[model samples]
Structures are given as C-alpha cells and as structure tokens.
Target: MAKLTKKQKEAHAKIDKSKSYDLAAASSLVKEITNVKFDASVDIAIRLGVDPRKANQMVRGVVTLPHGTGKDVKVLALVTPDKEAEAKEAGADYVGLDEYLQKIKNGWTDVDVIITLPSVMGKLGPLGRILGPRGLMPNPKTGTVTMDVAKAVQEVKAGKIDFKVDKTGIVHAAIGKVSFDAEKIAENAKEILQTVIKLKPTTAKGTYLRSIHISSTMSPAVIVDVKTV
Candidate 1:
C-alpha cells in the first residue's frame, strides 16, 4: 500500500470509527473548514447551503424504492371488482373498493399507503387535508392516481424513496447503509444524484444543482464531485 498522507489517514480513520454510514468524514470536513458544531443532520445539511428564502431552488420528488420501506408499508389499493385480482396479483395488502371508502374513512389512521384508481378520489371528499400533511394522499402529479394497482404495490414494497427540498433547498433520502458494499452504496447514491439532476426545474435560473453530497442515515454528508457524476 502507498504511504498515507495525514489528511487521507484522518479521513479514513473517521469513517472506520463510525461503524455504520454515520458519515463521519463529511462531518469532519465541516468541522475542519467551518468550525460549526453540529450533529449528523445539521452536519449533513450545512453542505446544501441552499438559500431557503428562495422556494424555486428547492429539490423535491419521489422515486420507487428498490428494497421496499425498511419497515413494512402495508399497501391498500382502492379498486373495482374488475381490478381486485390485479391488485392482489400486484401484492396489495388490502384490496379495497369504493364501498370500503366509508370503512377506511372510519379507520383512516390504520392505513400506511393508499393507491386509488382514477375514479376513487371523489369519495375521499375533504380528507385530503388529513392525508396530505401526512403525505398519504395520492395526487396525480406524483403518479399516485392511476389504475395500475400491481405496479404501485410492487414499488411500495421495494422501498420507494422520496426526496423533497427542506427549508435549505436540500433534498435527502435514505438509500441504504455502509454495511452495504461501497460499490453498491455509491451506485445508489449516484442514482439519487442523477434523479435530482433530471428534476432541475427549467424555470430556475443560476446553477440548477448547486452541489451534491452523499451521507448515510446518521452520518455527515461529504461533498462528492458532481463532474464525475
């Protein structure tokens, strides 16, 4: 092995001590340059440095999770008799019909994700306010309102990742962990970067992607080279 420089030695040492993808190296970088005291989230967030005052720069979108939610996201699909079998074939935990709308309304909190055929939203009434804040409402723009029940269930089971810009115009999502091989994690990270790159709004001026960083669930984000990305 080539002799390690002091900086490289320190960087690797931080990651080694972190056990999981705590993103220690990224935190070390912030401490080194900014001298800002921070925990993992703040440490990772500072790198975004996106001006929150400007709403247009925010990055937000949704992606089908490849590994399903780390937690079982019980999927419920609202469909007609014609579509029930397809929904079942697609792995819906519960295949509901228009009639069950009342039953679901009575027991709304029990559901995790809701998939509705194009016709079901009418029955939802004003409950969107209740579901919207929790991000449970199925909106057409996000590809939630559709008749394709099987695909919806499969995507949910595979850990569909969601990215939304925070107050600082930063988008973050959980891809996996350091326990995963470096190549796999890097690949997942790259996919996220690519998604964000494509999501850059044409209306937004200035640099669409101000910067790109990768961080594990509890780690600091390290600024990755976007040019190579």
Candidate 2:
C-alpha cells in the first residue's frame, strides 16, 4: 500500500473511525479535513438496504439542493430550432441539435448536463452508447428529456441533480463545495438524504439507510450516524 502523506495522515487523524457523527458535525469536520488548494467538492455516500438488481427495490430520483452546487453546471440544449431561443434564454451553455449531435458522435461531451425535447430523444437513441456510460443520457424519469426545454435547463442550472443506486446499493452524490459554509453543506446533505428516504422502496426490507458518510474530494470519509440523519 502507498504511504499516506502528512496532510492525508492529518486528515485521517481528525476523525474517530469507531464513532459516527451527526450531519452537522460531519459536515463541519469534512471542511476542516480538506487540505486541497482548490475548492474540493463535498460528497455524500449512502448505502441503502435495497437491492439495485431488483426492479421494485431500485432507488433513483432527483433533488434540488438548498444551496446550488458550487460548480457551474454546463448544460447542452439539444433541441429543435424552434426551442433554441427558449433554451438559450434559460441559460443553456450550448444550444443546438444536429451540430451538437455530431459533436457527441465524434466523442465531444464537454457539457455537464444535456437537456433536450421529447421529439429529440429519437435522434439521441443512436448515440446512447456514447452518452449512457458517462451518465449524460437525458432520461424522462430525471426530467432531462422533456418538451419544456426552458424549465429543464433552468432546473439543472439551479442545483437540480439526479442520482441512482449503483449495483452495490450505494448512492453517491456531490452535495456542495468545501468552500461553502458548514450550514450549506449540511443542508445540501439533508436535502439529498431526505429525498432518498422518501424514495425507499416498499419491497425493501429492514433498514433502508444502512450507512452514510460525508467527505470532500480529497479528504477522509467522516461517518455520519444514520440515526441523526
């Protein structure tokens, strides 16, 4: 194993591995432990009891963070010419259809979120291989594929994010940046956590939320008590 650097060691030393912290305490501690020069993203990892393999137990949904994700979300509006103006007016960074489709075909997915009209989805189907793995495929369930281009673009720019449970039953999402106040981080974390709780599947047995952890891009994970969440 690679030896930990002094900063990494110091970050690990600040937390007690045996104890789980409340959301507020974990949020504050994560900021304190992050030593990266740039503003690191604060992420929360939640392990749920549900099995992603089961259709009924699969958990996936969207939530708008109380404080917008500190990162500026670059949105691509893949819409017809008629909706181009609306998408642009809604603050989409890239607005177009065929030209952008060709760009993606040539492996240029430079944007964060892709919003497109329902009519445009058929054209996108052929490019699923390129977009699916990158989590860029706009799906109706997540409100990414819709007729209301402006609303979709605005929501994405305003901190709306979609998350799905991985095969291992863990849901990982970036809540905010380390530069944000602890309160903002805590609130963002709460927003996602509460949303996840509400999405608990009826088929899921036992504890829905198994374990929760909060950390920054480069910091050690801080265990968050499931009870306190």
Best by lDDT: 2
Taking all chains together, the TM-score of candidate 1 against the true structure is: 0.66
Taking the tens digit of each residue's C-alpha lDDT, what string does model 2 give over 45-143? Answer: 999999899999999999999898899999999999999899999999999999999999999989999998888899999999999999999999999
lDDT at 76, model 2 = 99
Estimate TM-scores for all models: 0.66, 0.99
Query: What is model 1's C-alpha RMSD?
Result: 8.8
| Candidate number with greatest TM-score | 2
Model 2 stretches astray by more than 4 angstroms? none
Tell me the tens digit of each residue's lDDT in model 1 across 46-151.
2243455666656667775343324557877888888899988988888867556766566565667788888878877567667777767776655567877788
Q: In model 1, where do residues sit more than 4 Å from their true spots?
A: 1-60, 65-71, 98-107, 110-112
**Residue-pair clash count for candidate 1:** 10
How many backbone clashes does every candidate have?
10, 0
RMSD of each: 8.8, 0.7
